[model samples]
Every structure is written in C-alpha cells, then in structure tokens.
Target: MYKLGFIGMGNMASAIQEGFINSGYIKADEICGFDLSEIATEKAKARGVTPLSDGHEVIRNAEIIFMAVKPQVVEKVVAPLKEDLKGKALVSMVLGYDFAKYETMLDPSTRHLTFMPNTPIAVGEGMILLEDQQTLTDDEYDFIKKAFESAGSVEVLPSHLMGVGGALSGCAPAYIYMVIEALADGAVAQGLPRASAYKLASQTVLGSGKMQLASGLHPGILKDNVTSPAGSTIKGVKALEDGGLRAAFINAIEKSMGK
Candidate 1:
C-alpha cells in the first residue's frame, strides 16, 4: 500500500483523509499526519491516522506528502525540511503558491504539484483543480490523479489557469451556499417552514446542476426551457436580473481573485 502523510491536520486534510478512507482507496494504517496543535493531532488520531512528532517525521515516513498548511506559514514550515523532502512527491494545497516557489525553496528534483479542492470533498463530491511542474513521471502523476479521484471529479489544467479555475470552482461553493440560503429565505417569506424551505431550495439547485452536466446543454438554453413567456419562472428571473444577480456573481469571482 502507498503511504500518505499530511503535514497539517486541518479541515481540508481531514476531508481528504475521510474521502480516501470512505472510498476504500487508502487504508487508515497507511496514513500519518502531524500538526502543531495537539487538538488537531488528536482529531487526526481519532480518525485512525498516526500522529507524528513533526513535519519531518511525516515526510520521512510517507512517500507522498501533503502540504496542507496556510500559504503564509508554508515557507516557514517547509524551509527547514528541505533536506527531508528530497525524492518525495509533494502535493500542496496552499492557495496562490506555485511550483516555482517550491522548486526555489526545496530540491529542484522534488516532484511537486499544486491542487485546489473545495469543502465538498468531505462528501466525495468535490471539484478538484490540478497543475504540475513537469517534474513527475507518468506513473507518479497517474498515482496522484487516481488518489484524488476518490474524493471527487478532478481536472488537470495549465498552471496559469489554476487561479481562474480556483476562483470559479473553489470559491463558488460559498457563493452557491449563499444562493441556497437566499432562495430558502424567499420560501420562508412565503410562509413555508424554514427546514422545508432549505430542503426544497437545496434540492432544486442540486437537481438543476446535475441536469446541466448530464444534458451537456448551454445553461442559457436550459434556463429558456424552464422560463415561459408569461409565467412565474420568467418573472422570478426578471427580478433576479433586475437585482443584478449575474453581475454580482461575476464581481464575486473577480474580487475573489483580487481583481
């Protein structure tokens, strides 16, 4: 079995671990992790991960190491462990950090990859964006891709596109949650029970998303199908348009990317 090590035991790492174990793609015994917070390590241990003494211990024990630390502290955390990371495949989840920075900090020969995965990975329905620095062999790349496939759908894209893709899929989940909440609020305003409103709104969004994917049709066409010339749906859509819903979403993405 391939050994997996996580250098941080935060939410994202925990989610990935859960997805791997739940999908039967990786065994608990094959994983090790480390975190500065005792509570974080304890939580990881509760999930059957072996909690290590430090990041170096994790790097030493596992062939594939996940760098799940924050972007701000990544350099501080990884700089000291440069020697230990040699010959290992480093999978980084730090946002806005690139492979070039990793190569500059650590051994250039170190196989490195950067990926963006949303919170949905906890339920095995995530959208993951991947970019590599041409350092991994075919087998190594395939292994990493297959490992992440257990969590959700994976898309490999150019390094330059990671930022745009991350904004679209990575940050869009929060936007979607907001949309669901607003829709539910509208239902509640109409005198529906709060719980039923949330369920109805959430299921509607889920089914609509699935239909768009399965049908392979333009979303505008799909919207037209649901909208009649003189109907409630059209009226609702017009209200949304009047409220600048489209521009709000587009601005949200742009703002998320620091534009």
Candidate 2:
C-alpha cells in the first residue's frame, strides 16, 4: 500500500504532497491521489504523485488517507464510500468540520484527525493546528505529528480550541499579507521603489516573526523594544494603535469563529 492517499489533489493537497516529499518523510512514489481536475492531476504528477483513477482507488491502495475536499462536498463525496472507510485513518483538512461531526459520518472503528493548515504549507513554513483526538494510536499520532513538523510548526489543541487556533494561525496569514502590502504601499508613497518597498516590508515581517519565535519573547515586549521614546517607530505604532489595528484583529478573529 502507498504511504499516503489524497482524495482531492487541489492546491492544499499538492502542498501537503510537496511537504512530504521535501521533508523526505514520504516518497513521491509512495503517495497516490485522485482529482477530477486535469490541471490538478498534472500538478500533482509534476511533484511525483501517482494519479489514481478514483478516490476509492486511492483509499484502497494507501495506508493513511487524507481528505482535503471542500466542506460543502464532504458529505457528497464520502457517503458512497463510507463503508469502505471503516477502520481507516482519515486526516481531514476540510474547514468547519470537527471530530464530533466526523464520528457521526464515519464508522465507529475509523480513526479521524482534523487539521487546519494554511496556504504557507506550500513554502514549508505553515502553522498547522491539529485537534487532539484519542481515536488514533500512539504510533499513528506520532507519524502524523512528525510528518507535519517536518514541514512546519505543529500545535496540538483540544477540539474546542481548534476554531480559535485555526483563526489565529490559518486565517491570519491573509491579514499579514495585507499588512505587508500596506506597509509597502506606505513606503511607495514616501518615494521608495515599489519592488524595494515590497522586499523590505516582507523581509521585515519575516525577520520579526523569526525573532519572536527564536527569543520566545512576548510580541508586546518586542514591540516595546523597537518603539523608543519620541522615535519614528513609536509614531508609527501610535498611528496603528489609533487606527484600531489591535481591535480590528480581535474582531476579525471573533467573526471568523462565529462569536
């Protein structure tokens, strides 16, 4: 059997496959998947993923199955194959679906793992939020954890916190990208070249994130370190604070979590 099987070989699945191969955790030939889109199949093939005839063929031939289908079509896709999934380990990347819901959809003996991975997974810097599920064996959990850690950071949270954690890590990337763009726009307005501005803004954000992670310091402390008394940085900080940046982020997360 193949090591990993993907039901939907879209961008996310392609990223996962790339991560597995890049990390040397799983070989390309050992992975197989199916996608209705010819373009998706071609992309997967470029990454050395073996294209399967159908989702059932993927599941029947692989040890662990990853279901990356859209949330709206999850039921439609799985209903026909629900019986075939018995006792199988399913790693689901579908949004808005939780472990409790899976328990009702899948067989009692089937093991399920729900994870939220952002678009950054394509670059090996993704933050993955995995729900803590006891249904999986120790070895199974270890394999899944190591697989993702090989690509990026992995956080194991209880099901209750998955939504908020996903919002912070999964959904926040877009916000960061927007911030980077805005910073670049501000620099351009101040007469900096567009390319240089984007590079500077992007790299600054990247470096700040690395520093925060490496130093294990609070972001507020890091901010304070940069904002000196009556300095330019402090002025910018005041502008952001005055603009309600912090509150905007808080409200965004609340809205994403349906609060």
Candidate 3:
C-alpha cells in the first residue's frame, strides 16, 4: 500500500483522507497522522489511520507527508521535519504560504506540491487547485492528478492566477450557501413554511444551474428567456438589481481576498 502521512488531523485533512478511501484510491490503513492532541490522534485512529506521537515520526516513516496543519503552525512543524524530508514527497494544504516560504524549511531534495483543497471534498464534489515548483513530466502530472481525481475536479492552475482564481472557487460553496439562504428567506417572507421555502429555493437553484450547463447558453440569454415583459420575474429581478445584489457578491469576494 502507498502510505500517506498527515501531520494534522483537522477537518481538511480528514476530508481528503475520507475522499481517498471512499473513492478507492487509498485504503484507510495506508494513511497515518501524528498529533500532539490526544483528541486528534484518537479521531484519526477511529478513522483507521495509524497514530503517532509526533510529526517527526511521520516524516521518517511516510513516503508522502502532508503538512495539513494550520498556516501559522506550518513553519514550526516543517522545521523539525526538514531533515527527514529528503527524498520523500511533501504536499501542503496550508493556504497563503507559498513554495519558497516552505523551501526555506525543507531539504532541497524534497519534492513539494502545493495543493489548495476546499472543505467540500468531504462530500466528494470539490474544486481542487494544484500548483507545483518542480517540473513534472506528463506521466508524473497524471499520477498526481489520479490522487486528486478521487477527491474533486482537480485543475492545473497557473501559479500567478492562483490568488485571484482561488478567491472564487475556494469560497464558492459558502457564497452559494448564502444565496440559498437568501432565496429561502424571500420565500419565507411570502408566507411559505421554512421547510417548504428551503425545498423550493434549493431545487430552483439546482435546476437552474443544471439547465445552464446542459443548454450551453450564456446565462444572460437564459435569464432573458425567463423574464417576459409582463412577467413577475422581471419585477423580482428589478428589486434584486435595485438592492445591489451583484455588487454585494463582488464586495464580499474582495473582502475575503483582503483577509
């Protein structure tokens, strides 16, 4: 079995691990995590992973070490594991920190991959972004792709674009949720029961998205088809436009990027 070592047993790590197992790419026993917290270690153990006392042991043992800890702890955790990082693969799930920042703490021989995975991979429908420093051959790239294929729709994004593009897909699920909630709120305001409002809003959103994808038409054109001159939709759409809904989303993204 190909072994993967995770240094942190947080939500993102657990999600990816579960994704791998459920997709049959990797077995649970083939993965391991080293955590100082007893709770974390126990959680990983319950998930069928080998538990270790410290991150160093994971570095020494695992062929592929995932630095899945929080961003602030990454530098500290990686420093101790640097000596053992040689010849092994290191994949990082820590956001904001780049390859150069990590290289300062890793052995030069380590093959490092920066993988940006969102929380949605827990359900197996995630958008994952991979950016790497080392030049990989087509076969090497495909091999890496296979691992992520089990988690989500993986893409090779240019390093420069990662910052801007990540703001969209990385935070898409949350954005979508807020929209769904707002839609439900509108329905509930009109006297629909909360459960019924949610049902209607969720299905409409899902169905509309599927329609756009299946029809392969521009969204504006598709929307135009829905809003006849005398239709109720145009008035509702007018209220949305007047409320600056589009501008609100734009500002939300910009605010997220600032953080």
Against the reference, the lDDT scores of all candidates come to 0.88, 0.90, 0.79
In candidate 1 the C-alpha lDDT for residue 24 amounts to 83
Choose 2 or 3, whichever is better by TM-score: 2
In candidate 2, stretches whose alpha carbon ends up further than 4 angstroms from where it belongs are none
Off by over 4 Å in 3: 135-141, 210-216
**After best superposition, candidate 2 residue 128: deviation in angstroms?**
0.9
* Candidate 3: residue 16 Cα off by (Å): 1.5
lDDT of 1 at 92: 91
The lowest-lDDT stretch of 10 consecutive residues in candidate 2 is 132-141
Query: TM-scores of the models, in the given order?
Result: 0.95, 0.96, 0.87
Going through the candidates in the order shown, the clash numbers are: 0, 0, 0
lDDT tens digits by residue: candidate 2, 31-110 = 99999999999999988889999988988999889999998999999898798899888999998888998988998988
Q: Candidate 3, after superposition: displacement of residue 168 in Å?
A: 1.4
- Candidate 2 has which clashing residue pairs, if any? none
